[model samples]
Target: MRAWRFHEPGNIANLVLEEVDTPPLNIGEALVRLECAALNPADRYLVQGQYPRAGAPPFTPGRDGAGTVVEVGPDSRFTPGDKVCLLGGGLTGVSLPGTLAEYAPLPEAWLAPIPDAWTFEQAATTLTSLTAWRALEICGGLQSNDTVLVTGASGGVGVAAVFLAKALGARIVALSRSAEKRKNLIALGADAAIDTESSTLEKEVRAAAGDQPISLVIENLGGPYLEKSVRMVAPEGRIMVIGLLADLTATVTIGLLIHKNIRIQGMSVNNFKAKEAQDAWTKIVDLYNANHHRPPISQVFPFAQVQEAFAHLQAGPMGKVLVRCSA
Candidate 1:
């Protein structure tokens, strides 16, 4: 099999594609022939040494993908030819060899069966959608009556949150620097879209809140965006910090933190237990099955252009960027 590997992390420039032996299918794991793999910011970060190297090199970086199961370990629930969505096995790309290769062995727990008749590209969205779902539903305890705010609203998780929040009947206030993306967010069912580039972040957020306060904030940009979220969220509001597209460190107001009874929780899909992941995936599947919420794909690059794919993601894509893995 052919795979991408980086000997010592520096940047995407270090990534090299070459022939490697296929990973062995171990107990409780299944061998999947990948059709598509999703590129994420974390994958880019790993290449640049900004993300953790779970183990030694040569590191294989990837997490989300869609594929067909060709073999299963003893007593596996999935059978041969099962159309499956790869949730990237938590941090498989960092911890072990991952889905960027044509063939991957994924744990049974991380592989979810694709919804009937869904495209591989759609199935490739499972990881990002589930991250958004867990952040909103589980950590934030979102309610239909709540007015939600999504930061970095054009991002992969942000887009999913918009669609999911809309499906669950929440009024959304989306924030983006791009006017065009703001328009797209409005069309995707956000009640309001604010500009992140504005100097008056607090004022813009408050105005977007209007009469109904922002009950929940899905904070994707950690530093300045999170600080703004803390100041603007309604009293007793919940903030789920799931992404660090901006710098990881944020100096939040302790006064507001104490006075408002605000609950801020940091969430990562990589830390999910098997049951948490399974339950969240089930909910995602059910939500998409309802035929209202669909994950958006902005681009699909052939496997040969893997470097270009990461470059495009770093340049900032409006939605999911995919790599076609089948050769």
Candidate 2:
């Protein structure tokens, strides 16, 4: 098998595609022949040694993909030729070799059957949606009448949160730095798309929410948005911090927390337990079945151009970029 490997993890462009032996399957694991894989910003950061959860050098870097099960070890529910795809990230590409390879030995618990309505591309492009499901729906307990706010709304997880929250009957507001991307956010079901860099962001959000309060917030970073979120969030609302695209630390007003009873939490897709991860994956499939809006595809590069794929990912695409691993 040929896999992309990094020896020192300094630059994504330094990744080398080399022939390597297939990983051996363990109990409750399946060896999947990957058809396609999705590329996230984290993948490049992992290869570049910027991600906190990245494994040591000499490992493949990928989190989500869809493939066919070529074999299964003992005690696994899947058999030969079962269609499976990955959602969350923890062991894959971190402690274990990731799905970027042609074949990956993955725990059956982290793999879910691809929905019948989705193609291999659709299934592979769903990592951010699964992240949003965990962040917005499960962690935040989003309700139909709730007004949801998603910071960095043009990014993968933020875009998915807007769409998923809307599909679940919540009115959503999308915040992005790009004026053009904000237009796309409105089409994705956000009640309003506001510029994250705007001076009067809180006032704009208040207008968007109308009578309802901002009951749930999916904050993308700890920078400028953190202080504003504390002020805009309604009493007893939940704020789930899922991304730190900016600085690692931000100042917050403790008074707001004590007065409004705002609950703030930080989470990652990799942190969910088995049962909750499976449930999130199941709900994502159902949600896609209804609207089939796979995150927009910016490009799909073949395996040989793996270096180019990372470049595209770093260029800040408007949507998902992918790698076709097999013929």
Candidate 3:
């Protein structure tokens, strides 16, 4: 099998494509012939040896992908030719063989059947949608008619958050620096879109909020933006931290939390229980089938252009980037 193997990751250039032995199918696991794999910002961090699991190299690198089962191990629930999508490989390409290759062995628990109406590219992008759903529902506790603020609203999780928030009958104020992307967010059901580049982000958000304060904030950018989000939340409003695009460490005024009684929760798909993940998947698939949500694909690169795909994601794509693992 040919895979994008990390030798000693310092950059994407260090990820060399070479023939590697296929992983042996173990009990409770199934072998999937990948059709498409989506790249996340986490992949970039893994390449830079910034991710915790990005220790020793010589492993394949990818986390989320969609494929068909080619072989199922003993006790596995999947059957050959079953279409499936998976979310975690615990830092794949870092600690384990990942979806960047033509095939991967995934634990049955992590595999979810893909809908017939969805394409492989769409299935590959489901992890972000699931993350968004989990963030809004489980972490943020968003309710109908709730006004939610979504930062980094142009990215995969952000866009999905907008769509899911709309589907739940929640009002959304999406934030993005690009004016064009802000327009796109509005088209995707954002009640209002604020340009993050504006010096008066708080003013714009407050203006959009009118009287009712933000009931929930889906924060993607951490660091200083988190402080702003903390300030924007209504009294006792929850803020869900999904990603730290700016800085890992953040500083916020302690007085704000004490005064407003804000609730801050970190949202990670890895931390979700099986039932929670299943619930999220069900909602995402139903939304897709209802034409209420669609995974935005910014670009699709061939398997050979895996490096380019990583580079594109690192440059901050407006939507999801995918690698075509097979024809």
lDDT of 1 by residue, 1-327 (tens): 998888887878898888899989888899999999999888877877887646467877788889999999889999999999877537677686777889988888888888786899988977778888888887889899999999988988899998888888899999888889999999988889988888887787788778999999999899877888998899999999988888879899899999999999998877777777878877777887795566888799999899999888777678798999998
Better of 2 and 3 by TM-score: 3
Off by over 4 Å in 1: none
Task: State residue 235's C-alpha deviation in candidate 1, in Å.
Answer: 1.2
lDDT: worst 10-residue window of model 3: 87-96
lDDT of 2 at 295: 63
TM-score of 2: 0.91
As a whole number from 0 to 100, the lDDT of residue 219 in candidate 3 is 90
Provide TM-scores for the models.
0.95, 0.91, 0.94
RMSD of 3: 1.7
Q: On a 0 to 100 scale, what is the lDDT of residue 277 in model 1?
A: 83
Output the number of the TM-score-best candidate: 1
Candidate 2 local lDDT, 83-168, one digit each (tens): 98886554787667887899998878888888886777778876788788888777888889899999878777877788889889
Model 3, C-alpha of 18: deviation from truth (Å): 1.6
What TM-score, to 2 decimals, does candidate 1 have? 0.95
Ranking by TM-score: 1, 3, 2
